[model samples]
Target: MTEQHDEPRSGTSSPAAASPALARLVGMPAPDFAEHVWSRAPLLTRGSDLPRDFADLFGPDAVDELVARRALRTPFARMAKDGTTLADRTFTLGGGVGAGIGDQLSEDRVLRELAGGATLVLQALHRSWAPVQDFAAALADDLGHPVQVNAYVTPPQNQGFSDHYDVHDVFVLQVAGEKRWRIRPPVLEAPLRDQPWERHRAAVEQAAQSEPFLEETLRPGDCLYLPRGWLHSATALGGTSIHLTIGVHAWTRRHLVDAVLGRIGARLSADVEARRSLPVDPGRSSGSEVAFGEDAEVVRSLVAKALHDLSVGEVVEALRPQVRAAQRAEPLGVLDQVERATHDEQGGTTWRVRRHLAAHWEDAGDSPVLVSRVGRLEVSADDRDAVAEVLDGIRDAGDLDPRLRRRLALAGLLVPADVSGE
Candidate 1:
């Protein structure tokens, strides 16, 4: 059984600092979820507090407002009728307020289609909606994985897409209304990104005819967790249904191996012997295979050498900064940043490392540096303590090296503590 822990101790460096983060979304703790249900089965938790947690995200009113007033264009918003995607032009038109602006959401057309049993989909709301952006950022940081959100508003008794399996794991939060879901086991277990449900259409359809992995109607405040490759379909019941799918694109061991391989490849390529040309004797037959002898030995030696040179810890350490850099950072204004760093040594302003930044100090290399999602900064030994202090948490501006603080702030790694929350 999944067990939830009390929220992490105060002043934890990251949201995920409390054990595994998957528990925050599900009531279960991370360890139990990973061992019992993760990548293994489906889970439905009813009467969850998610409805209140995400009360401001999306619903019938939000759909109406987005369709009528948001001036959204293609891709950002779309419609599907009876499992078929509808054309954008069918629900979009030129913005009336300006000429040659762009195609925008057509309220009348959207409402008409909805009335005709079409489901409206809002794509990538984290980029357009502030609250979603914040929630997604927090979740991503907590999970140590990239997260994206999409909202679906379906009419009563209507569905969005047909029975299909997602390539990424998803947590469906029933924000409003209710929907009946019919879910079956994966046709191909733990499918990769390229292995879509369409690849096994006949198999999926055949399986759908049999008993489902789960058959339940999720009401508001309920949540369902489906690992990637699980086939599922949902239809609204009684009233319009609205749900947010938080897709988690998990980073896997294969990725970590690849990262290590890349580092190994670079090191091997730098060796002169490893770069030597292969022996291609004119007398040798080129038919189907080449005779394996010294060439094979050389190849084996190269592989052995590469493996011998590889260091998992070093590769992983290098990877952390790259992953951290993938996150977006909020920068303090360049003008103000420069001013404070240059002239505000005595100012009362406090500064802190931007939240959710996977900041790491890399001192092993010849150039000691602080790397973060915002950017990387090369620093001298004298400035290492100051940078570390700043990264620890909120600190008085005067206590830090003003020049380094300004540089980090300018690089978008740090922000004034006051405005950082915004």
Candidate 2:
């Protein structure tokens, strides 16, 4: 399964006396866990309070299968001189699998060349994987964006990657063993360069010109958050090291403008003036076709206005739920059959609801009432009576009320328990 790192420490200053160690790291203002701060700076913590028994999340057979498939790379992931590694790992049947498999690790090539059958482990964070999914959901809610997990295993002396940076911000968790990380200062601050592979190759060839701002060895339970565009490299120290990189998606004003422009383009073809033939110039002796100017300025202006409207908070808010819904929708379809079964007198009912664990929503003051078996609920003071009525049924039936239950079932909120007949 794709490994997940622990959540990074909140860099915010506590009113209470701070630890000397924490004081040193909290030099810059701690970034708010909003959409923007991800992958932008350094936030490190040692002996974190976050759950550390990462291996327990995966089954022994599954772990063995991943290893046997040669999915885990060792002794430094090999990269082409150009700093790009070709990825050939097939993704499992989930959204998380697709995101994790998209990237290449150096060891993948060596294993394939050696004719190994080990498959790369993919961890799914649906409601079924409750603990991990809970953490994921919290992070998504905190960050107001979708999050996915990807893990790489590097053996001692093996460098999983050459000196490079990611397009998105990453939270790295050291699950087991040790890894030495060297992070250079944010150079190309929030760079918009599209060709990261080429940039990585160039940076590697010119390593002598750059220096790392922070260099440290991360042991188990350590967490590091690195912002986008910061150059860094990691190598396993002396034993097998497993690390999780929680990547956050980046959105920009340019992306919003692009979307608006696309909408405008679709409407332009309907303009009769734009489609009309240019007026022919008969007076000229030359037989070349005359070109007339189409008034595209109006369309451009409209697109710019639309983009301006979208540049503020509304666009992100509008897009957030849609994005969350899409991620939440995936496991929902798969869990449908599981939610349909009725419980017999002898068997306990199992109900499963799929929730995207990423911190995708902004908590607007009031905490939304989220019940595992009932699906996501937005309760208001006015609806307290209704909510209590539903809760009454939940307490009695060990499920939601019938109408609400059917709705939740249809929404993939509650699935039938997979129970053996008594």
Q: What is the per-residue lDDT of model 2 for residues 30-81, given as tens digits with 9 covering 90 to 100? A: 2432322344456565644332434543333433454344343321122221
Question: For residues 1-422, could you state the per-residue lDDT of candidate 1 as single tens digits?
Answer: 12112332121122233643344456555555555666667777654432244566566677777778788887898999777999988888888656445668889888888999999888888777776777777777666778888999899999878888998889888888889999888889888777888899999889889887678888877778888998999999988889999888877676787787788778768888778886677644754345546677776788787888777786887577557755566434677766665655676667766777677777866678776676667888877776777677545444766666667667777666676443
Scored by lDDT, model 1 comes in at 0.74
**Please, what is the TM-score per model?**
0.84, 0.59
The global C-alpha lDDT for each of the candidates, from Candidate 1 onward, is 0.74, 0.49
Q: Pick the candidate with the highest lDDT.
A: 1
